[model samples]
Target: MIFETERLIVREWRDTPDDLDRVFEIYRHDEVTRWIGMEEPLKSPDEARTVMTRWQARYEKNEHKYGPWAMEIKASGIVAGTVLLGPLPEPSDGSEGRGEIEVGWHLHPDSWGHGYATEAARGALELAFGRYEVPEVYAVAYPTNERSIAVMQRLGMSPRGLTTRWYGREAQCYVTLPRQRAASN
Candidate 1:
């Protein structure tokens, strides 16, 4: 496991059937998938398995400090979402990408509005700054995603404006550095 909060446990994504099913459920919802880079909700469980297997393989390398994680609620042992603390995917142009660590999350709609996203993100950011010692971490969302924007603000990230570099579509970017994490620290 990467870390834990009072109400959540953050761990690497697994390739097991149960994890694949949960990942599929989380990524298959339109509300969750729309703002994510996916062109549409994943087509099937097979697709979720493929993605989860890839993450398992990457984590198996044992070189990455962080990557996509499964967010499990402490009281229920239910995975309510997926969280990420890692380098943003390199841009297709082969140019230098944002070159910063990133923090991101997508929770099941049923788990929304309960502060789970914010709580789990706080734990991830702690790892990013405390363990990983990254200078800065970023977050991006579709311009219209008010929920994630609010989370960014709660995390003390400053608005860095918009960009299309990561996903080839306009995305509002926000950033936070170790200095800004003082309050959260």
Candidate 2:
């Protein structure tokens, strides 16, 4: 599941052979773990390694089929962050037939505002539409996260409604209609 965008590579998962310290380095980065939810941000590289290990196991089981993809920047070849897609059974409120896949992204804070989120997201959108036969894509973000909301807007997506149950709090729900609009443009 390696998808190459114009400037990034979205892959399933990879276990780098970096040193012990480096394994924790990305974890210890506050900016990197900001949007991630945990009782506390990652405290050390070991902790991050454990989390990534779990991700690896999940991918081994093909659990990520409807979830996130690792976002790697082509220029740096470094794993910057990840883009998430939602259609999973857990969080979904039985909305599979709704014709949409919830989209999300989390870039290291350093990668913020660099178009990486949008680029990687576009790739996910392409996959969702092209491969999944998904008729539409959607996203939900805290209303205050102006950047994510902006990226959704830039993707030609618009809000269908707002809901508080999404992330355990209110969020703006954005949606992109069927692909027919692509031809209208």
Best lDDT among the predictions, by candidate number: 1
Backbone clashes for every candidate come to: 0, 1
68-178: candidate 1 lDDT, tens digit per residue:
888999999889998888888787545687667889999989899989988988888889888888889999999999999999999888999988778777899998988
Among all windows of 10 consecutive residues in model 1, the one with the lowest summed lDDT is 91-100
Supply the global lDDT for candidate 2.
0.68
Model 2 spans with C-alpha error above 4 angstroms: 19-36, 60-64, 88-100, 180-185
Model 2 poorest 10 in a row by lDDT: 88-97
Q: How much is 25 displaced in model 1, in angstroms?
A: 1.1
Extract clashing residue pairs from model 1. none
lDDT of 1 at 185: 50
> Among these predicted structures, which one has the highest TM-score?
1
Instruction: Assess each prediction's global lDDT (C-alpha) against the native.
Output: 0.86, 0.68
